[model samples]
Target: MPQWSDYTNGQRIKILRGREITQPQLAERCGLSVVTIQKAEQDKVLSLTTLLRIAGALGVDTSVILGQQAPRRAMSMDDRAMLRELSRAVHDSWVGLLPRTVAAPSADELRAAVDACWARYWEGHYAEAGAIVAPLLEAATAHRHEQPHDRQATAWGLISDAHRLAAYVANLMGARDLAYAAIGHAQEAAESAADNMRHALVTSGRAWVYLRDSRLKAALDLAEKSAVDIEPRFSRATPGELVAYGSHVNFAAVVAARLEKKERAKEFLSQSHAAGARLGEEIAAHGTRWGPVSATTQAVGVNVGLGRIGKALALADDIKDVSALSPAAQNRYSMDLALAQAHARQWDASLDTLEETLTKAPEWSRHQVLPGVIVEKVGRASTARLRRVSKLLGVSNPVTGGFDTATEKSAL
Candidate 1:
């Protein structure tokens, strides 16, 4: 049997709570949403306030929640360095004064840089993405000031996108404060741009922030309202406008799922899918990957969140190949598939899928809590595979004896 020290922070919480306390019960006690509790137990991005609430709900000291009382493995040097760089980039974007008299990159050059940053982000090269965005944000900000009025609009759009990219990366890293700062900057730039589509895009980013913070209903409302506000007449909508509207609708569907509004979620998802079909091809507009494949991939997670395990698996099957999607999106969809499979008691199949996903995107897998959650569900049957995955992800294997139930509830 593995010792308590073998478990991750999330696993420890699960162990302490025992099977008697389901996630929904724990969430209710903590005044948090079920998704928030699930994320916390998976050791995903969670705020300090959330940690404190969990500790309180479980009647445990905060050190238990932080895993400070237990001897545990430390994060790798590479991961530590990446986090430091991410924090620095977020800080710089919020505080560093813009330089005056800076020669600006041509519009084409700036566009190329933004394009590269988005590519890196989608590829799950978050640290590399961070390295590019700081300079891109500075240059765009400086250019907005230096360029003539006619060019200023273009520069503002660039600045808004750069900040939005920063927020997206920071949010993925679980840095909520940094993500908030970046979103604020994005919104400011969007206002200056005076483009309705740009404002709608920033609103979508803000909705993501709310979702991450466990404000499910708020996130859903914001996403639904923004999608409605920016709903372009499909017959005449530009590619960018279509992408923005579709992305917002997609996010709203996920939020609705978390809220357990099944019918509403389905309605939003159908709308998003229709938008994607109209586009016909995957479009990465302002870093939102909106298209048929992307919409379908998102639907898998939505189904998982809605507790439709069989439905989620069916959706996963529909996505014949995810190679065309961004690396980040591919991994996300894979996680959803694995979660659904595990819930259905297809242990071997779940392990196989997870192994393939981790191999394809090791770095991205490290930050995700789903793998850990799945391992916990499979218990002793998954020991060998779990160890390999733990070594690959540089995290501890979840202990199997924590939950009394044969099958743990889905944590999607």
Candidate 2:
């Protein structure tokens, strides 16, 4: 077993560095002087209260510092290199510090900084984005810590966006738990701000996460509730262009489909479509991370739930390769295809599609979006028919059913 003392000072420092926080910074955040933090780092003996405070400051758990578990190691050389670049960018951006007497930066400036981060990140310049926004995030953290009332709500709201974006990138990079934790922090800040749009988005994002995890009922409940406060809580968007509200409706459609509530699914999908149309023109004019309300992917699922095999197939054909979507979306599309193929009695095609969906990525499993789930449903039905055919053919061993044996375990 790896013990706490097994870690060297260098290792601890590396962990601290990777966390993007400094000991002195933690001290400042915890209302302790720098010298006290220096002693703790040098002695590797942090008080429980100090550890808790530092952990909170770093958006981590206390076990992280107590060495209860080894810290998250860097991934590839690419990940390490990227982290270094990001750290450097953060440091360089903070090179100038106006006097403590100077007024803190304005919320609009921080919001602009967040926007710049997204532009660079979307362009695939991870380091540059990291550099541009790292200091801004740090400064915001410091401001909230030192001067709690200075634009407190706005500061937390913007900080939530920064963390949420980071979580998005992290999920793309395959650090799932870390991504979840980042989103959790973002939600906490958003709630602290009491900003409805941000709050709705955070809940909508979690519903998406739950959908990926195959918790359909949980996803449905959260998504529906999220959209309830759309008009009353936040006037951030027009009544029709409430993008987050549209997303909730879409998620509800997905859950309804998964639960085999064909009528409910169709109703929700139509509502989503209407909401999307209302909101679409105001948005980027192009779709966002959430697919269009009338997305063929969602339509495919609705068709499958309704047992309209031909309709499902028609919708599936219209969908482009949906692999670029998030795992939840991809799984929704793949499962629809699998179910449709099974309904059409295209056994080979159904098995092939299901296998293909499962093999795309490992997150497909951890996140519980396995296409094999629908396969199992079809497999049982096929087995009974095979047994009937075998009796008529007088064959003890019949290979009529083409279903993979593993599908038997995935029955709905």
| Candidate achieving the largest lDDT | 1
lDDT tens digits, residue span 1-412, model 2: 2344577543553356445657666577778777766766676556777666555555444565656654333233335344444333233323433235434466777666677676655444444554555465565665565456855787778767766665555544444564576667678889889887788777766666665555678877877777665533233555434555565666666666667777777777776666655544324210134335335576776666566779889877776665545445565566668777877878767766765655553333222322434444555555444343333222243352222233211222
lDDT of each: 0.76, 0.56
| Tens digits of lDDT, candidate 1, 1-412 | 5655677888888876765678999899899999998998888967889988887677555775666664212223333345455556555644646546445787788899999999998888877787788778777766666788876888888888888888887776666687898888888888888878788888888888888777777888888888888988999988887888888888888888888899999999998998899999888876767889888999888888889998888878777877768888888888888878888988878878888988988877765556776767765564556667556555544453222222222232
Error of 2 at 32 (Å): 36
Model 2 gets an lDDT of: 0.56
Q: Give the TM-score of candidate 1.
A: 0.75
State each model's C-alpha RMSD to the native: 11.7, 12.8
- What's the distance in Å from true for residue 348, model 1? 0.8
Candidate 2 residue spans exceeding 4 A from truth: 1-150, 169-176, 231-240, 280-282, 285-296, 301-309, 316-412
Reference-based lDDT, residue 279, model 1: 90
